[model samples]
Target: MGRKRKTKIFMIMIAFVLFLAGCNFNSSESSNEETGGSEGETKQVLNISTTADIPTLDSTKAHDGIAFTVLNNVNEGLYRQDENNEPIEALVTEHKENEDKTVHTFTLRDSNWSNGDPVTAQDFEYAWKRVMKDASPYNFMFVTAGIKNSEAIMNEEMDTEDLGIKAIDEKTVEVTLEAANPLFQSLMTFPTFLPQNQKFVEEQGDQYALEAENVLFNGPFTLVDWTHEQGWKYEKNEDYWDADAVKLDAINAYVVKDPAAGINLYETNKVDRIVLSSEAVDQNKDDENFDTILEPEILFLRFNHNHPVLGNKNIRQAVNMAIDKKSLTDVILKNGSTPLDGIVPKGFFKSPAGEDFRDINGDFNTGTVEEAQKVWETGLKEAGVEEVNVSINIADSEDHKKVAEYIQAQLEDNLPGFKLNIKAVPFAQRLEIEKAIDYDLSLSSWGPDYSDPMTYLDMWLEGGSANRMDYSNAKLEELVASARTETDLEKRYQMLLDTEKILLEEDAAIAPLYQDGTAVLMRSKIKNLLVHPTGASFSYKWVTIEE
Candidate 1:
């Protein structure tokens, strides 16, 4: 549900699924083939191969980390987390917090835009005002709710800037809040907080994020071109404040999902990086370049609570009891990942008693199937339901497709007369389908924008507010809202546990499969790529490639 929790589960799975670690393999990624296709000078590019592709270049439209990875290279934030994970100044040189923590004053560096215009506080102020507008698709508005009158301001009941941020001068800006938010600084480091060119967005509207040519940047790199849903490439921005740390001359990303094809490309030197699968991992475990890194991501099954059958708690429980999460982890994904016990994975913030968010007693899995059936049978009989046929939605990734197949097979075999359908769609198509709430069920995961438990809690709301799951729980919403005011990590963590327990025991809107761990391959010839424990974020300013 959250990155910290997902990452913890992944590392733990390394021990639990050690037997399947045989898939950990490394093969030589060498290409001796000649390149004769291009007539002119070849671009000096740091090629990266990923099983997933960037879905959008526009920051507002971007939700996936894959897209954010590219954006981090292309655009920057007011502040940034260094290698130590500490928030140091990036665009703003210094920040002054008010006594009540309701206000902050920032000093912007005298940096020029890519076109040589001075980057100033007004730009940030303007961008923030736009993000607060009702048209924006981001949850950043919730963070702004504490700003004085921000709620009314967003509803168009008040004038702009009445929400609490102001540009005092060309370089100085001040932000006033409705309450104290200790996490405000850290939250600003996220992409959702990445400032934009207000003039550009206001003028372009829906077309603002549609192409590379329409965008501007103050970050390490600039997106030179974009093809929408197709892969876009990034080139170093000569105007970047820390251009010296930039490494790759350019980066090329392709929208791909076939792990075998990606691995083959890496092996042939067609691509410098790739996502390796379980079979490929097992095949090349002995290679010299073998590497493993765990990321804070997961693959979970979302139950459409609006659906007649799935909406019933009993039916949801029966579906959960029928599947085997351990086998999915121990047998199929030899790659590091743990079987989830509850909606909130372990490793999230802990309680004063050090209790985790997952419920130890009520979590249903393989062992609890017998219990699940009793509820399911009762539900089916009451709903007058005879046949249960369901379809699951997934992105067109090789792994996602395979996992869907496995799930379909497992459900059909384990539960007689239960018909299962699998619909594997492309990256963009899947995203749209999910938003429309068109599927009976789908595979989705939420990555925390910030460390707070509210990040995961917001997704369970009705009509699928975040990802459109059509899931809603009044009691869960109340728990999440109250938890946000809790500055005490331990107490907040306990609240999360209480809230998740109710969702699993009564709501059952989603059946979590496994906590996700990312498996990636890198080239030996590359040097100084900045990879953090947080996952695959690369800073070109400090990276270099060996000849």
Candidate 2:
């Protein structure tokens, strides 16, 4: 997930993967994880399924909130944007600001608790200070870094008060920003800034958050049951302040990725929705439930610049220009994955002139064994080396393995003296290995940060967390820093372009491949279900069932 910028958005995003009662994999019951059910009757359950198992629920430990909170309306932030992308109050009743934009205040909406108590501003205060104090790494803390002394507080230099949040009363809260962020209200729409009950969390200890009874939520739903391998389930939380608006009575989410099985479940009407493969699309294109969406997920190869051979631009570029993106898109991801040109995916940020990024005309000299060989030959000659043995790491999934296999064939064909080896591991495990730069080459995926160009462009900066490449460029770092503060949208975009140019076209530390829209097969009965631009899981809330 390239959600570094959306740290605030995903701070509250955690895990919740469930299985079924029949298969222990299809049950998707609610727990400490999962969401989505019918409105009036407890018998009406929406059995949903997915392809990947959630990683973990610890926000500080896991990036994606699997086993935690991909969906479920019980948790909420200060503000939330509606279908029109308009920012509106969620838990907060009103937002007040000073004339100078230096001070901000919020009035809570009398948000309720599962135990019938009023949700108060203290909840937000506790959650905020806790994350900063504990080094929660929820990314939301970073958004507040612009606040006075926030960075220092996160680094333990000052107390929580200096960190900039105050609960004046049971319903009132105040915050001071380092600078006026016009998007601040929209920023509050993220889960990171949401209120977490201090009373409830303190009582549970470490294990409290791992189950339903250990936590309290003020959202539209409540956690019912959760067990290992059995998917979580959720029912309506009638005590919520805005319970009347909630349409779903319960939501069943199953964590299984087998496309064939998922399709079968959908066919049997056991699943309300599922994700299909390119092959499945070909077969189900005519089915009524067949609806495909182009989502924000992008796939690419991250060079372990920490590796010996990866330090060279030539070798990196040879590998970068080698893979056939068109083949990957047209053949593998028939779900409309646009082949990338520069680091930023096409249409990451559109301009009056068109998209803000670059494209190599659907042909970046990738995919051809001959081109790879030529670049490799020159790279080897420049390094004064006759042979280079490299290992390419990939996720163990079938789709990922196919990608690795194709690239291996290309590398072997292009450079006879160079040996290409495959290092395959589970998706999450591969991420750990890649983070440590344990391989010469690794392929991975990233969704966006915000709806900004900086999300894709800033990752390659020196010392950036996402910069597993161990890549450093003085000029690149300068550009990234400047872009963050530029504020001028157009100028900021140009800064991103320059950064991408240096990282992809010039340094070649990373290879661009495909950007795709996620594909979803959903029950036509599922209405008001809006898949966010961020990714697939930021769903469940803001959705209603018609029947």
Scored by CA lDDT, what does every candidate get? Answer: 0.66, 0.65
Q: Please report the candidate that would top TM-score against the real structure.
A: 1
**Candidate 1 per-residue lDDT over residues 3-77, each given as its tens digit:** 998887566545323411231211122111121223553334666655565666666556676766776777777
Q: Where's the lowest-lDDT run of ten residues in candidate 2?
A: 10-19
The local distance difference test score of model 1 is 0.66
Which runs in model 2 stand beyond 4 Å of their true positions?
Answer: 1-19, 22-44, 59-62, 65-72, 115-117, 137-141, 152-161, 212-214, 352-369, 381-390, 417-424
What TM-score would candidate 1 get against the native?
0.85
- What stretches of model 1 exceed 4 Å from their correct place? 1-45, 144-161, 203-205, 227-230, 352-369, 531-540
lDDT of 2 at 462: 57
| lDDT, model 1, position 55 | 66
